[model samples]
Target: MVISSDSQRDLFSDTGALGFVQILLAEMHDDLLGKVARFRQLTDLSKTLGPGGTMIHGGEVAYTAWTEARNSFIHGNYIATVMLCQSLAENLLAAYIDTDLEAEKLPKRVSFNDTIRRCVSKGVFDKSFSGELITMMNIRNPLSHYRDLEDPSNLSRRVLDSRLPAIAHLMGDASFALAIAIKLLSLPPFWLSGETLK
Candidate 1:
């Protein structure tokens, strides 16, 4: 994504604004680098674990979704970013569950809330971590449904408190959610030999 020449000039015309934008851009760049590094680590870990064919495919899908989510966040599509993050989380949770149980044993289609609840009940994730996933999913709802903004039931207090107010805040929230998704996805299943999965 190249910044347009006009936009670049506008940013540079104001000394203070330029400084602030530069700082934000630098931080975003660093975050992208960190994500790349962690992705490489996850790839190496997957290789060592020698996950099955199904796991390998699921990892690829989850990674692709994660990358798209990051790009969306960078482009300031906050709602799309949040939605993609939620999808990534669901994909990871489903992959983990499938690793231990047969596909037929699971629900045909699981919602994000159901996925988190199932994972927590099965001990695949801790209650607190699952709570965070739930929080993230809750935040996605308002962005996903326009009417949710008017419905008090769909709006979450925590999300309202940490709502994206600016580019920096949006990036920060998206980055944090993406980080959580990546961490969960990178956790190799316990069934894999050689390393004991936490």
Candidate 2:
């Protein structure tokens, strides 16, 4: 059954849905007492960000991006995972550069690329790491915007439009996206900066 995009199906689709879910749950149940999961770092941001009252408003985006990105990865929404990771990195850099590290308005017309450049200039991240951030943008670019199929760098052609299988490419890219998010979230300046600038 193909549900149309406009369709609004109830969460409880049918009476048997609950029974099916219960069976699936039992199948997935793990008896292990301890299992270190890869999803932990990508799940929370408020703890890392600290006492609330952002550098500017809307810092909460970073929190949501992490959760959604993790969900996207685990659910096989690889494209969304890649895109959200890039967005998370950009927002973090913007937070650091917004209003001289104070709770002031972010400057006007600062592009995402410029936000990264500013972070490097302010010594927020070294020149080497600047390339890492840029790499995030590059990976996300094809997903975010249209790319010519003739171009060798077009990710859609490489991942979706191909006659051959591209699942491995997509899975690898999503994993790489998570790795980038983990590194950015773990950065001292980002996690320790908190909401206030002192």
* All candidates: TM-score: 0.55, 0.65
lDDT of 1 by residue, 70-130 (tens): 6675555656777788888888777767667543355778777777777778877789988
Report lDDT (Cα) of residue 40, candidate 1. 57
Question: Could you list the CA RMSD of all candidates, in the order they appear?
Answer: 9.7, 7.2
Per-residue alpha-carbon lDDT of candidate 2 for residues 1-198, written as tens digits (9 for 90 to 100): 987655745643555878898977774464222112434434543344324323322278877887788777766678889988887877767866774744445566567877877777777778887788787788788777887987665864775556545666766777788887776666656544334456
Instruction: Name the regions of candidate 2 deviating beyond 4 angstroms.
Output: 1-58, 99-105, 159-164, 193-198
Off by over 4 Å in 1: 1-61, 102-104, 148-169, 188-198
Q: Roughly what TM-score does model 2 have, to 2 decimal places?
A: 0.65
* Candidate 1: residue 31 Cα off by (Å): 14
Backbone N/Cα/C clashes per model: 0, 0
